[model samples]
Target chain A: MFNRAILIGLAVLLACVVAPAQFRRGGGNAPKEGADAPDFNLKVLKTKKKKIKLSSYEGKKPVALIFGSYT
Target chain B: MQFLLVYIREAHPSDERRGRGRGRGRGPEVKQPKTFEERTEVASECVENLKLSMPAVIDNMKNTAGTAYAGFPDRLFLVDKKGKIAYAGARGPRGFSPEKLEDSIKAVLKNKGVAPRKSTKNKKSQGRGN
Candidate 1:
């Protein structure tokens, strides 16, 4: 085994290497290509309790789903 | 091609009411919503500020859609007419690339029709290596 100083150095290097993963939290468990899109019926913005269903778009046209927040 | 926006959880909430702390968000500072109504309000404001013309839908209080797709903060996807995921974009904050997304969209649209066309010209003349 390496001496104490060398071991500490190795640990620090490893931590630095993997530190970016901690920042990029999500995106794992995301659906892959050719997989069935998850069906969701969410409330439409400014609508009178109306909802938009993802399944409704199927077989009609290609829908580009953009997921995001304001800030 | 049709575009739809699904407003999910707050990415960088200054108050850190729920999700991770991003110090100060790029746009106006917004706190994590404690209820569905608040989330809707913020999402509306966001669409307005960004001038997102496409229709939008708000995630529920539990963030079900966000958790289901693992699209916290932001993400992009293309669902083909068959309801299958045609393309899944990289994660957000840094991986959220619009250029790449546009390319994918173009590709999806190009393959929309299966019209078998006649091959007028042969590529044997310009074949480099195969």
Candidate 2:
């Protein structure tokens, strides 16, 4: 019974570590490769407060969209 | 190439997942932003702290851009000159590698016959999301 409990505890710990990572990456509906980039007219966090649209950059230059936030 | 950092929802707020803080044993204590203004404030702090050179944008309170890109935590997408995704970096944290991103960017530039401009500084930076 003690060994069984230990096994269950380990399993729960493993799930705790692995589950969140999977959920983070498993966010479905992300745009796919070779697809037209999704258009977004998001607010720029600068002094101008000007909104920038993704489509504006089309045919102008390559755009690298890095999605993240501050912790 | 133009770089844009899209600010999304907090990934590890103090209330949830409380990841390690700036120092030992203390988690980066932050609560999820309740309003767009609050979110933007947090994003501004992030940009200032990181000294990000690229322009930063805030996702809507509804998380429209974040939902479209599944951009929680972090991710990288290289859009080609034609507005198509040239390269999609894996979901980040563990999958985020600046070296791999740089390689992919170089590959895309090469395909476009664009010469990479030399830079005096060789600093490597990674974006951290809440």
Best candidate (score: lDDT): 2
Question: Chain A vs. true chain A, TM-score per candidate?
Answer: 0.60, 0.60
lDDT digits (tens) for residues B1-130 of candidate 1: 7898999988777677543444364468788889998998899899888888999999998888887777777888878888887767667766677886687677777877111122435223212110
What lDDT does each candidate get?
0.75, 0.76
Least lDDT summed over 10 consecutive residues: which range in candidate 2 chain B? B121-130
Instruction: Name the runs in model 2 displaced over 4 angstroms.
Output: A1-24, B17-27, B113-130
Question: lDDT by residue for model 2 over B1-130, one digit each (tens)?
Answer: 8999999998777655544443224434677898999998899888988899899989999999988887877888888888887666667776666776687688778878232433435212222121
Predictions: Cα RMSD each: 8.1, 8.6
Pairs that collide in candidate 2 are A69-B129, B10-B130, B11-B130
Candidate 2 local Cα displacement, residue A60, angstroms: 0.4
Give the DockQ (C-alpha) for candidate 2: 0.43
